[model samples]
Target: MAFNTCVSVIRSASHKAQMIHNQDVQAVSTDVINADELWSFVKKSKSTVNRKS
Candidate 1:
């Protein structure tokens, strides 16, 4: 039960953080983008990601 609670809290925080990040990203225009860094930040290889592909 404790583990599930912790996961829920972390997930909530992650969503909030992602939302803020998305807004920031949209507000700026950059010529160079690093896909690998973004993927690493979101844990692309792990199951925590909503979309694996």
Candidate 2:
């Protein structure tokens, strides 16, 4: 019975860790995409302003 309880606890902890890791991966990907998009917009705007001047 003790062994079974230990196994159950380990499984639960592992599952929680996996979920947290997945969430972190998603957040990082979203941040990277946002940064890339912002950079592109800034570059385009700078070029446009330079042309006008």
Give the best candidate by lDDT: 2
RMSD (CA, Å), candidate 2 to true, equals: 15.4
Per-residue lDDT of candidate 1, residues 1-52 (tens digit): 6999999999999999999999998899889877988788668557555564
Against the hidden reference, what TM-scores do the models get?
0.56, 0.50
Give the clashing residue pairs of candidate 1, or none. Answer: none
Candidate 2: stretches off by over 4 Å: 30-53
lDDT of 2 at 20: 97
**Each model's number of backbone clashes?**
0, 0
